[model samples]
Target: MLGAPLLEEASGIGALGIDLTSLLVYLINFTVLGLILYFMAYKRIIGMLDSRSERIRESLEEADRVRKESEEQQESMQKALDDGRQEGQRVLAEAREAAERYREQQAEQARAESEQIVSRAREEIKQERDAALESVRAEFAVLAVSAAEKIIKRSLDADAQQDLIDEVISESNAKQEQD
Candidate 1:
């Protein structure tokens, strides 16, 4: 009797295009394969994936740090360049000022030298004028004495003539001094 009912159930499942025992076997086989895969490969694959993800995150963090450091370095280099330019400008300005001062000093020195040269020239001209005047006075005195002697047609003794000439020169010098 139990066999008859089981055969009927099998026939019913066959009519539905299924065998219950084969379905049970397939379900058991699928469970075992799933367990095997989970124990043998799934955990390891997941672990590998987790490790890869961690490494990727670490790499991203490192790259970010490097980028930040590069930016800071670039900023520092720019600041240094600016400071160098400012210093160059300052040095150039100082050099220009120094050059201007040097030019002014040279000009002043030249002016002073020119003034000294001019003053020396004036002094020399004055001395030459005095010497020429003295020469002319001496010559004129000698000529006057000679002309008087010739006009009078009288000759004094040499000592007397010399004394008269001396007196005449002294009187002329006195007049010049008074003038």
Candidate 2:
């Protein structure tokens, strides 16, 4: 009966077409092929991937550095523009102040010159008035002497004539003062 059960189990396995020896051999060959492929190409592929990743990291770092430098340059340019505008305004203000000063100086000089001209004209008029007064006085004296000579019809002594002329002149001056 034991041999009979063993024979029946073997017949069942044969009916299923399952062989232990063939399964074992297939497992061994698959393991060896996997190991060979890993040794031949796996390390080189991993190395290439690592190098590419490092290159990408370096490129990103360089781009960041360039962006920072560009920002700094923009700030510097803005500062320079602001300073130039302030300087231009200052220069314009100074120029305006200088022009105002020059105008004031010119006006003052013109006023001084005009005053001098008026003073000179006044002095000239005064001199002319004095000369005319002297001429009239001399003419009046000549007329008085001629009238006295004609009224008297006789030659008077020089001292007596001079006294008469002095009395007449003093009386006329007194009359003018009272009026």
Candidate 3:
């Protein structure tokens, strides 16, 4: 029964103009061509593609590393700039403080010198006043002696005149002190 179905199938294919031996030869040729192409060209093309892919990956990684390093350098530069600004401010503050201290010292020295000058002037005035008072007292005593000699109308002994003048000067001094 299987032989009969095969014969019928073969006859059907023959009516359609199909030759089995030629079809087999064509299939064998196609398989051989495919295998040759895979060995000769396909593997080399795949290897080249793989190498290119690896190079692209490495380039990407290197670019990322360079970018990170650049960022770190920029941060360091910024930090240095900030520190410099702070140092400048600190120096300026110190200079201002020193100037203020110098001004205060100069003021204090000027005040001390002025006080000393004023004290000397007052002492000189007091000494001049005392000298003027002594001169007036001596002139008054001489005038009193001349008046007493005229009243008496006689030349008194030198000792009596001297004693009289001393007594008058002492009385005046005592009165002045009481007043």
Candidate 4:
């Protein structure tokens, strides 16, 4: 009687069209296929993704380094340009100083030359004045001798004449000194 209840339960499960052996076989096949695909394709796909990520990271680092180098180059170029401008200004200032010195020297030279010309002209005038004074003194002595001869109304010897001329000249020099 116990076996009869067991057979009845088995028939009832069969009536629902369920096969336990085929279900176990299909489960085993699906598990084996999933494991094979994981081993062969999944690992390679993950490795490819990791390698691509590493390449992208390296490219970004290279771009950052290049940007830093370009910034450094630009700073150096600006410094060089500033230095060039300073050097040009210094050279221009030196040139201006040199020109000013040249102008001063030329002016001083002209002044010295003019002074020399003026000094020469003054010396010439003094020499001419002395010569004219000497000529006037000689003519005055001759006129005095002639006037004396007319006042005496007589001819004198050469010694007397010379003595008289010497006296008259001394008297004239005394009068000029008193005046």
- Tell me how far the alpha carbon of residue 64 in candidate 2 is from the true structure, in angstroms, after superposition: 2.7
Of models 1 and 3, which has the larger TM-score?
1
Each model's TM-score? 0.67, 0.54, 0.51, 0.51
Per-residue C-alpha lDDT of model 4 across residues 16-72, encoded as one tens digit per residue: 546677788889999998899888888888888999999999999999999999999
Candidate 1 C-alpha RMSD relative to the actual structure: 5.5
Task: Estimate the Cα RMSD of every predicted model relative to the unseen true structure.
Answer: 5.5, 7.7, 7.5, 8.2
Q: Give, for candidate 3, the lowest lDDT window spanning 10 residues.
A: 1-10
* Over 4 Å off, model 2: 1-55, 136-179
lDDT at residue 124 of model 4 (Cα atoms)? 84
The segments of candidate 4 whose C-alpha lies over 4 angstroms from its true place after superposition are: 1-40, 117-179
Worst 10 residues of 4 by lDDT: 1-10
Q: How many backbone clashes does candidate 4 have?
A: 0
> Which window of ten consecutive residues has the lowest lDDT sum in model 2?
1-10
The lDDT, on a scale of 0 to 1, for candidate 4 is: 0.80
Candidate 1: give the clashing pairs: none
**Candidate 3 lDDT score at position 116:** 88
Candidate 3: lDDT of 128? 89
The lDDT per prediction is: 0.89, 0.79, 0.83, 0.80
Which candidate wins on TM-score? 1
